[model samples]
Structure formats: structure tokens, C-alpha cells
Target: MNVRSARGAAARLAGRKGEIWAAIWLMARGYRILGFRLKTPQAEIDLLAKRGPILAVVEVKRRASLGAALEAVGHDQRQRLRRAGVTLAARRPSLAGASVRLDLMALAPGKLPRHIPDAWKGE
Candidate 1:
């Protein structure tokens, strides 16, 4: 494999690890994982979770810093995730009546995962 492909693979692996950690962290905090790497036409949701009546649409990022991880999701990405969440809820009967929330799970080395709820709301 070329250098670019190898780097891409490594990044993907790290992202998968981050998603797993994020899911575990959420579960520990009373959230139940519904899906992982859920691909819709509009976007890919890193993790889907639920706690009570809230359906959390999570975007997981592993960056050098928690702030960088939070900033990694930009305007366009947020829009896509919003659309994707709507589409997912419309198609999934089980998600009916649950409030959809966009969440960001930031993972950095030597630190616990940071979860930001309603991350892009009113932004």
C-alpha cells in the first residue's frame, strides 16, 4: 500500500477505536447503544444511542486535543448529521416519539471521553 493509503487505514482504525470507547463511555453513563457507523445517504453517524426518550446522534472524533475534536465537526458536517437524523427517525419505527439530539464525543489521549449534547443547536 502507498503512504496515503496506509495513513488512511491508520486513521480509520483510530476512529473505530474512538467510537468503541465513546459507546462504552455512554453506556456507562446510562445510555444504550443503538447502532454504530450508521450510514445514511446524507451522512454517517458514528454512534446512535438512547437514554430515556432521547435518541442521541453521536459524532466521534479522536484528536490531539478535546477542543480540536469538537471543532472537527464543522458547519457542513452538522447540517448533514441533522438531515441524516431526520431521515433515520422517519424510517425507524422504534425511534418514534423520541427526541433527536446531535451529540459530539471527543476522545483525546490521557483523558476521558468528553460528550457534548445538543452540540450544534442554535449555532
Candidate 2:
């Protein structure tokens, strides 16, 4: 394969591995993982989890720094996440009454995953 294709494949593989690591971290922290790569018409949520009565829609960024990771989630991305959360709640009635939160899971280079719950207010 070409160099570009090989690099793309490698990146995708690394991303998948990062997601697994993030999920494991969350599970160990007493969060129950509900789904990964959940897609809606608006956008894709990297992970969906439950910690007690709260429903967390997580965005995972595997980046070189926490700032870069957080920067990756911009205004449009936040809107998409809000829409996706609405869609998710509609599809799963059980989650309708649960408190919804937008979360960020940043996997910085050579560091543990950072879980930022309610990362954004969507204001």
C-alpha cells in the first residue's frame, strides 16, 4: 500500500487502541460502558457511559497535549454532541429521565487518561 494509506491505517488502529484503554479506565472507575462510536445524524459520540443516574456522552481525544485534546472539541462539535444526546435519549427511553452530561476523555502522550465530566455547558 501507499505511505499515506499505511499511515491512515496505523492512525486508525492507534485510535481504536486508545478508545479501548479509555473504556477500561472508565470501567475501573465504576462507570458502566454502554456503547462506543455511537453515531447519529448530527455527529458521533466516542463513548456512552453511566455513572449511577447520570448519562455521559464522551468525546475521546488522543493527542500530544491536554490543550490540543480539549481544543479538538470545538463549538460545532459541542452542538453535534448535544443533538446526538437528544437522539440517544429519544431512542432509549430509559435514559430519558437521566441527567445528561458532555464529557471529554483526553489521552495525552505518556500520561493516564483524563476524564473531564461535564466538560462543556453548551451555552
Candidate 3:
């Protein structure tokens, strides 16, 4: 429709593509994708993955550059994602005994998806 709306739609499409790419990359590295685009009342997690006894809540960001993507998820966002990961673990019986952590996947044009595991500090 409008230019702004069209740009927003395109951005969303690009973000979804980035997420799918990140998931595939993770799978190749032995991580099994459990979920994506999970939204709750408190927060939203872009992707959930498992590798052995580790369950990761991944935040996917696609931007003009890798640095831009990495900076997209700030301190507040990390805290929210951490909280969501905890909530996800608590609500899922299957994730019991698994260590839950926060991860980040940064994607940019002509670049590979960068997966940063346990990028946030938690108590």
C-alpha cells in the first residue's frame, strides 16, 4: 500500500528469511530447532533451539551490517529475552533438566549468520 507500510513489510520478510537462515545454520552445527516467533504476554522469543542438555532462546536480527545487527538487541532487550527464556523453560515440561540460555543470531547482506551463545549475563 503506502511506501512506509511496504518498507515495513519488506523488513519483516527479510527478518523472517534471516531467522530461517539462522535456524538452518544452527541445525548444521548440531542444534535442533524447537520453535520460532514465540510470543507471550511478557515477551517474545525469535527462536528456540536445543543441543544436548542446553536449550537456547535465540534472538535473530538482520540489518545493514553485522555490527548493526549485533547492536540491535540492547541491554533491555537482553533482559526481556532472558526473562522469556526462563518463562519458556518453566512452562515446558520437556525442557526440564535442560539449561536454558540466551543466544543471538546476527545476519547481514552478503554475510553469514553469526551465532553468539550465552551472550547475556544472568544470575
Candidate 4:
């Protein structure tokens, strides 16, 4: 494989690992993980979780630094996630009553996962 492709593959694996870590972190914090890598026409949600009446569409980013991870989810991505969240709730009858939210989880080496609840309220 070319160096670029190899880097891309490694990045994908790291992201997948981060998603798993994010799910477990949320579960540890009392959130029930509904799904991961939930894909839709609008966007791809890294993790979908629930706690009480809240249904969270989570985006997970893995970077060497927290700042880099946090910066990864920009305005456009947030909007996409919002649409995905709405679509998820609309399509899932079980999640209809829950209020959907866009959440962010930033993962960095040797640091705890940083979760931002209701990270964006985009339409």
C-alpha cells in the first residue's frame, strides 16, 4: 500500500478505537449506548447514546492533542450531525419521545475522553 493509504487506514482504525472508547466511557457515566457508526444520507453518527429523555448523536474524534480533536468537528460537521440526529429519531419509533442532541467526544492519548453534551444545536 502507498504511504497515504496506509496513513488513512491507520487513521480509520484509530477512529474506530476511539468510538469504542467513547461508548464505554459514556456507559461508565450511566449513558446507555444505542448504536455506533450509525450512517444516514445526511451524516454519520459516531455514537448514539441515551440517558433519561435525551438521545445523543455523538461524534468521536481521536487526535494526539485534545485541541486537535476538539477542532476536528467544525460548523459543517455539526450541522450534518444535527440532521442525522433528527433523522435517527424520526426513523426510530423507540427514540421518538426522546429529545435528540448533538454530542462531541474528543479523545487524546493518555488523557480522559472529553465529552461535550449538546455541543451544537444546528438545524
Model 2, which residues run further than 4 Å from truth? none
For candidate 2, write residues 13-91 as lDDT tens digits: 9888888998999999999999999878899888999888888898989989888988889988898897888778778
Q: What is the C-alpha lDDT of each candidate?
A: 0.91, 0.88, 0.86, 0.87
Residue 68 lDDT (model 2): 92
TM-score of each: 0.94, 0.94, 0.92, 0.91
The worst-scoring run of ten residues by lDDT in candidate 1 lies at 62-71
Better of 3 and 4 by lDDT: 4
Query: Tens digit of lDDT per residue, candidate 4, span 31-92?
Result: 99998898899888899999999999888987787678767888888888888888888898
lDDT of 3 by residue, 1-123 (tens): 999999999989987888899999999999999999999766788999999999999999877776787678888788888888888888899988888888888877787778888866563
For model 4, where is the 10-residue window of minimal lDDT?
A: 114-123
**When superposed on Cα atoms, how far off is each prediction in RMSD?**
1.1, 1.1, 1.5, 1.7
* Residue 54, candidate 2: alpha-carbon lDDT: 88
**Span of 10 residues, lowest total lDDT, candidate 2:** 114-123
Better of 1 and 4 by TM-score: 1
Total clashing pairs for each candidate: 0, 0, 0, 0
